[model samples]
Target: MSDLVYEILQLAGILAFAISGALVGVRRRLDLLGVVVVGAFTGVGGGIVRDMLLGVHPPVSFVHWPNLAVAIGGSLVVFFVHPGITRIRHFEVVFDAFGLGLFSANGAATALEAGQTPLTAILVGTITAIGGGVIRDVLVNTVPGVLTRELYAVSALFGAGIAVGIEGLGGDAWLASIVGGAAAIVLRLTSVARGWHLPKPRFTDERAATQE
Candidate 1:
């Protein structure tokens, strides 16, 4: 992927993540600083972790001013300017889904660019997608959505796989990213509406049966 396009995707993900986190903070009734802090962390947390796992020294997010600037700027915008942002139903899930799509697709592309195998690309992409949301939920003292939300992480996994597959087949990176992101978003929202869940374990199923 061209650096320009990659940068754009990262920025979009950061903004979405920041908005989501800020919304969560508002829901929790946190102070302005707290909201900004949570938003900043959510915006950059995934990318920082992804860089470390990929063995990128110093983590690009740490040294790059734009990453921090954009993150903080996004947080500020969400916290101060958009009090009604969370009025949208499932606001957190919606913005987080957007972040997940962009970040996951870009993560896979970055992994491929770093000369990693397809499997590594997929894993990195999935992690990049969910890592920030995990941090956000933790900070808010809530269960991470990926653990309980069906098709959440699955969306990232499928999207990442698709992105890698497209790149492997010599497709344009932008097209691959768009398709991958759209797939993840659609699957995630559909799962939400349909209440589709991954199958429970046999023991859980047996316990439920006994209860019944």
Candidate 2:
């Protein structure tokens, strides 16, 4: 994960998250401008938050033309040519998974570059991965998937931790990002495919008891 590679991954993540937001916008029947706005926020909102937390006055995404361009391009592509409405949810999840992994690792790399501690880097990574999605969902008036979706935040946390661990073990940020992002993506997709998730408390059925 050289600088070039990390940049590429960041672009990919931007595109993926933009696509996620665009899909949701389309499903929600928003207009073109609305869809684009949603997509842009989804692509860069997390990075903006991360920068703010790190005390970077001017967020990188705000000044980066390429980031805005990629986000808009992804939105246009999805708006113009995408799956049927019924398939939007599936595609949204796919793209969101990709974004989640790359952004998580990217966040860790950025934090490390800023000389943050391992714990802070990892936490920032997880926040960067999920913050955009959370915003996207809120804008669309839906529950954030990270709260209820199968193994969402856990995957991000694991990915960030892996990246930090790699860096701590004498690996460069690039290698850590690549490995950690891949780990997150694999775990997320696998959890979706296999219905793996954290355990939830089950309550006995009050209706059954009343009936008995």
Candidate 3:
């Protein structure tokens, strides 16, 4: 992919991730600084971890201040502007699904570009998709969605799988990323809209009482 295209994807993914982070903070009624912290952390935590695992010093976001600027700015925009941005009756899931698609695909591509194996790429993709949200949930005192939702990690895995397959077939990075992202978004949105959940373990009364 062209340097310009790579940079654009990275920025778009970061912006969307940070926006969701800020929204989470907003929902929790956090102060402005708290919002920024949560947003920045959620936006870049996975990428930073990925780079560290790859032995890249300073990581991409730290090396380039624009990444930090974009994330922080995005969060601040949400903090101050989202309130006045005209409330959509259904904005929550809409933005959440969009962010899911953007970040998960970018994460998978980044992992593959760093020369991770296919399985590792998929794992990284799942981490990148949920890492931020996990942090956000912990900070906000909620359960991480992926822990309870069947389709969350599944979507990321599916995207990463598609990305690896496409690249293995000699497809362009941009095209692969797009297809992967679109697939993730569609599947995730469908799961949410349909209220699809993973099966939970059932305990017998005797086992439950014994455990208790």
Candidate 4:
């Protein structure tokens, strides 16, 4: 993808995630500062983690001031319009899905650009998609959504894998990004609507009691 397109996707992902995080903070009754802080974390946390793992010093989010500016803008908007925003059903899910798709594609593409292996790229992409939300949930003392939500990280993995596969096949980077992101969004939304979940192992009473 062109640098312009990549930057646009990054900004959009930051804004979407920031809005979701700010909403969560508001729901948890955090003050304005706390809401903004949560929003910033959700916007840039994943990217920071990915960059650090890739050995990119200072992280792009820090060097690119617009990323932080857009995140704070999203938080302020949520802060002022939370009443109307909260009235929208599944708002968080919708925004979170968008962020997941964009960030997953971008993250995988970035890792590949940095000469990482396909498997490592996929893992980093999944982490980039979910890391921020994990931090947000922990801040509020809630279980991270990826751990309990329907096919969350799975969706990221699928998306990242698609991006890697497309590039490996010599496809256009933009096409790979678009297809991968769309796949992630569709999978996540479908899972949510259908209440699909990964199967959990059921422990026998005897085993459970023995383990306990």
Candidate 5:
């Protein structure tokens, strides 16, 4: 994708995740400072991790003022306008889905640009999509959504795989990004609406009898 488009996607992802984190902070009854802190972490923590893993010194989120500005601005807006925002049903879920999609696509694309293999790019993209949420949930002492929620990381992986596949096939980067992101958003929303979940092993209720 073009640099401008990539930056725009990054900004959108940052704002979306920031709003979700700020909302969680408000729900947790954190003070304004705490809210902003949570918001900033949730917005940029994943990107920082991704950049660090890619060996990008200083990380883009730190050097780019607009990224931090957008994150803080999103939190400030949420702090001031939370009353109306909270009234919207599933507000957090919606924003989280958007952020997941955007981050997954952008992360995979960036990894490819950094010359990562497809599998590595997919893994990096999945991490980039969910790492911030994991941090946010840990800060609030809750289980991370990727561990318990419906297909969260799975959705990110799917999106990242699509992006990697498209790029491997010589498709346009921007088109790959859009398609990958849309795929993630659609899968995540559908899973949420339909209560789809990954299956876990269940132990048998009856125990074996002891030998005489």
Candidate 6:
């Protein structure tokens, strides 16, 4: 795809992700400032980290005013509008899944553009997809979705891996992103619909007592 389209996709994905993060802040009853902070963090935290690791000085967030603007703007809208765009019964979960898929694709692409190996690209992509949510959960005093749900990280990993695989196969970057995003979205949606979960380690009464 053209650079123009890629840039647009990147921005749109970031804005969508920011809105989801802001919703989380709203659900937690945070103030407007907190909403903006969480939204911006969620939108750009992973990309920033990935760029830093890849030695992309300043990262796109610093160089691109629109990226920051969209994030903050999305947060503002979410703060004042609440769930402005949806009346779905599971709007939060749906949007969170959308953001996860979007960011996973974007992150993986960014890693490859930075000349990272396929494995590293996928890892960076996974981090990019989940890092913001992790930070948001930490701020809100809850375990991240990935820590509690096996499917969350797995979904991201699948998407990132697909992106890396496609790029390695010499496919178009945009096409690769779509494939990766679809894989992530399908995995997450399926898991949610099916109530799939990773098992937690079992502890016997004796084991618990011994630990205590």
Q: RMSD in Å for candidate 4, one decimal?
A: 2.2
Q: Candidate 1 or 5, higher lDDT?
A: 5
What is the C-alpha lDDT profile of model 1 across 66-152, one tens digit per residue?
888888888787777775564644877788889999888888878888899999999998999999999999999999988988688
Q: TM-scores of all models?
A: 0.90, 0.92, 0.88, 0.93, 0.93, 0.89
Task: Give Cα distance to truth, residue 114, candidate 2, Å.
Answer: 1.1
lDDT of 6 by residue, 80-112 (tens): 877565652266567667778877876897788
State the displacement of the C-alpha of residue 46, model 2, in Å, after optimal TM-score superposition.
1.1
- The runs of at least 3 residues in candidate 4 whose Cα sits more than 4 Å from the true structure, single-residue gaps closed, are 86-89, 203-212
Candidate 5, 44-153: lDDT as tens digits: 98899899989999999989999999999999998889887644338888888888998898899889878999999999999999988998899989999999999999
Error of 2 at 200 (Å): 2.1
Give Cα-based local distance difference scores for all models: 0.86, 0.89, 0.76, 0.88, 0.90, 0.81
Higher-TM-score candidate among 2 and 4? Answer: 4
- Tens digits of lDDT, candidate 2, 1-212: 47688779889988999999999899898989989989989998888888998999898888889988999999988888865456678888899999999989888977987899999999999999998899999999989989988899999998999999999999988888888999999999999999998987564985664563
Which of 1 and 6 is the better model by lDDT? 1
Weakest ten-residue segment in model 2 by summed lDDT:
203-212
Better of 3 and 4 by TM-score: 4
Candidate 1 minimal-lDDT segment of 10 residues: 80-89
User: Candidate 4's residue-wise lDDT over 1-212, tens digit each?
Assistant: 78988888889889988888988888888999999999889988888889998999989898989999999999999989988764543888898898899889888987887899999999998999998889888887899999999999999999999988998899867777778888999999999999999997676675684573
Residue-pair clashes per candidate: 0, 0, 0, 0, 0, 0
TM-score of 1: 0.90
Clashing pairs in 4: none
Runs with alpha carbons beyond 4 Å of true place in candidate 6: 83-89, 206-212
Candidate 3, clashing residue pairs?
A: none
Where is model 3 more than 4 Å wrong at Cα? 85-90, 203-212
| Selected candidate, larger TM-score, 4 vs 6 | 4
